[model samples]
Target: MTSRDTVTDPLPSGRGAALPDGGGVPASPPIPPRLLTDLIDSAVRDHGERRAIDFLGRRWTYAEIGALVDRAAAGLQAMGVGPDVRFGLCLPNTPYFVILYFAALRCGATIVNFNPLYVEHELRHQIRDSGTTVMAVIDVASIHAKVAAVAEESGLEKIIVCPLADILPTFTSLLYRLFKRSEIARWPADARHMAFGDLTRANPASFKPVAVTPDDVAVLQYTGGTTGVPKGAMLTHANLTANSHQMTLHVGHGAEANDRIMGVLPMFHVFALTTVLNFSVDTAAEMILLPRFELKQFLKTVKRTRPTKLLAVPTMLTALNKAAASQDVHFDDLDFVVSGGAPLPFDVRQEFERVTGARVVEGYGLSETSPILTCNPITGVVKDNSAGPPFPGTTLEIRSLDDPHRIMPQGERGEVCARGPQVMKGYWNKPEETEKVFVDGAIRTGDVGYLDEDGYLFLVDRIKDVIICGGYNVYPRVIEEALYEHPAILEAVVIGVKDDYRGQAPKAFVVLRPGQSASTAEIAEFLKTRLSKIELPREIEIRQSLPKTLIGKLSKKELVAEEAKKAAG
Candidate 1:
């Protein structure tokens, strides 16, 4: 069978054959369609006294959080937030992200998640593109100032300013107000601005409920992926909730009933939105929240909070491995850390497991599919370097590169396409782009990979990232993985650069671990046996650090542009 015109995957693992009618036996119970708002209500009802959030020693129980959500929802409604209103959340991982997220949804408004690190121009573009009228941001000058400028330029209606020090423990809040005063911004006294404390009032009587449906747009998750063109994936309530359920099914429950998840990944990012935030809320787990992934803070969070599970990007594992080499660090309470949001190099996983004595499970998905389509099972035979298998309601099909409609034979490399309920409705308001991305009902994953006969996905690299070296396809990930096998290399990034001999050739940049070094020649020599001549990078440059996305994935966009500029000049 062939896909029509164009379009996408998910195949269940551990199954000899898929069910006849485009279905498969779920590894666990199927996730029923539901509203994202329902997750909070159920958690509060069943686990009211359970600790819901822990930020800088300040804690809130599920009941407390639910009450806050109620007040915020009422306030949001009074501020004219309801169906069709796009509410933007510009926040780091904090209690505010939790409250505002559900409150906006509870008001029957669609949320547009914004990265607080975005510059004014980036913020302006998304604000206009997403039609975000109201936004909530922290009082930190660096974030709020930019958003404020963007609001002025982009016609945003209201700003709910949250104080940085207000959410901390009393003594810590005092210290922050005294010492970190420079970081806070002074909001202009105007009608456009409101305090977060005021926005979430203490009156439950004023709260009015709006009926939320499973298909309502919950969040407009922006993803550029490898394409470099930012488009908002319209993730609905069902899409977000079902993916969270899929994660629970895949990971199952650890031996202990109480689980604390490390929330270092930014809440704005879909991976964390589903795994850390949504997953934790549904399971009644305490979220040990950090504003960002500072290495010292992460190690302290692991030891201090005793997080039973963590969802981390590759860079976090690298930092932990580097930290463990210097001093004693314990991850004893962690059942296992699931690595996603980027490819997990074998050496990084191996070293993390060996040094900290914590298990690492790798998963794969994109922002378009509610961010999780496949994951390595928590307590099962996990294949090394493969992104495990499809989640319970997903089907994966690998289509030929030349003709995407044709399904590739088993064990052959091609583009992965998936069909599942967890997939987004489409790109927001961009019908042409949306149509281009979908072919035959499956969401086309631009990733180049193949599924093994046993149904495990082994991703090669992004199709756009593949270098056509002397008319032969050469994957940068292959060379980068080889570079990781070296003792000194801490991080590796390879990008296709313009070459006179070949159309495009691979160029490598690496950062060495502390007190460890190897010249380009030594690294080239190391890769001689492992890689073919064509797979070798044209030139290797050693750098103190490499570029990374805010979520900590090693980025190739900057390097690609830098090389292009040099070539143009």
Candidate 2:
């Protein structure tokens, strides 16, 4: 039952050539097939008395949360959620997500995370693709409506509605229900709907522990693949737990109940799911949850909680860097900040650290790699424009872009490939697509980057046109496809444009059909229903003709260069 039990068929050493200090990648023994639930169990046993989560004015300790998970797991089992069951959680940051995530896994059900901002169209594709039968959603009107609309037509059968005011402080709950009652969605008392209170009231004695293993799929995190379509990465229990181990090792150890992690990123996102949620449970740190990040509220919470750690993306650092100069925010309590999910700019890091006195380090990985592989040393040398070195138990190499089979020399720009226990098994139900991403037993990252002599990874360019807006991946193809739906559009091309606020945002260029015309505002209004706010293009430029390749295929390279020139001007 120990955490370090041995595992067989270890990940290979994909490191092509050794560098100084063994390429700054620490060596470790074989990675064990560890279960994700084991991590929370261990934290509960060790730090049961410590505070585990804080949302709004409410809080729960590890022991209290563990008991809730037990009862919830029993209720889920009674609802026919067990082995081979796929449970979807479409919720924002709340205690319900924290409890249900582990509870569903404890019931031997595969967890499928959904973004609360998804429109009905996006929800339908994922539900059908992943075969999610039972779903947990917040009772907010728009969010619940989207799921309910898809439930009847899609494979989804049951919906577990969690209320927002249920976990709020008693007085706050009354005020929320009284004033914000219109936000609540109404559903009938039928077989398809269940309340959170009912889900958590089952007798703990009836909870039969299912026999779970490490290799079983734990979570289905969807990310845009090489084709710009969202695909679920089948993360095994071993993959997730090992990544937690690797993250804990990278962050180093701290005193018991010492750190409070600031979690502003969406819990459904892979980076925050691993770093903010799992990492806190692994270290027994108190997690201060914010439903969404607002500059005023974030600083207010920081002042109140005095958190020691902050898990952030580049845009967040950019905002804080600007706020620290004028606002009365004090970041003295922040020990360090780990920036991931998007590339962290050099000046953003330098300015933030200079003003706040907190060491901000950049990290890199994809959802397919349990969301983390390389991070700069916390208190050690941090190179500019580098994603630091590979974590222990992970091997990263630069493979030639043209030939996935060939590994490139050191400092050569090529696609980044990685192999480790933290890597997912493959895409769910897509064997043909899965086969194309792995070469020589390593996951092809589809990013053009090189490793320095010290083994630090530098991402030069992305092979895919995925725009990272405010730390979330926004696919250009998704936006382009949406634009083509307009009758007036004959040709469409989308590219990532630099923005001062969001690191990058999608920008659309379209050519109107002969004798047909559509205004930018008109096209934008059309896209509101088809695309999420983040997926919407910031600018839609109508043109007589869009740049095309020799074969008349829509091209984006010329558009990208033009944007760069304008930005320079």
Report each candidate's C-alpha RMSD, comma-separated, in the order given. 11.3, 2.7
Q: What shift in Å separates residue 412 of candidate 2 from its native position after superposition? A: 1.8
lDDT of candidate 1 at residue 29, scale 0 to 100? 53
The residue pairs found clashing in candidate 2 are none
Q: Write the per-residue lDDT of candidate 1 for residues 1-569, one digit (tens) a residue.
A: 11111111231111122322322223345557778888899889989999999997789999999999999888999999999899999999999999999999998999999888665666888999999999999999988988888787797999999998889999999988999989889999999999998887747688777887877789999876445456899998888888887777677662136789889888898888998899999888899999987877777767778888888877677777888999877788888988886667788889999986778999888889998888887787789999988887777778878987677777888888777767787888888888778766667888888888678888986765556554344667768888999999999999888765345678999999999979999999988756666678889999989999999999989998999999999
Tens digit of per-residue lDDT, candidate 2, span 1-569: 12234322444233222222212354465566678888789878988999989998589999999999999999999999998999999999999999999999999999999999999999999999999999999999999999999898998989999999888889999999999999988988999999999988899789888999887889999998777888999988888888887877777784354689998899999999998888898888899999998999899988888889999998888888889888767777888999998888889999998998889999999999998989999978899999989987777878777877677878888898887778888899998888888876678888889888888999999887688898888988898889889999988888999998889988998989999977899999999999999999899898888888999888888998999999999
| Candidate 1 segments exceeding 4 Å error | 1-28, 254-256, 465-569
Q: Give me the displacement of residue 548 in model 2, in angstroms.
A: 1.3
lDDT value for model 2: 0.86
TM-score of each: 0.79, 0.96
Candidate 1 Cα lDDT to native: 0.81
Off by over 4 Å in 2: 1-8, 11-26, 254-257
lDDT measured at residue 207 in model 1 versus the true structure, 0 to 100: 73
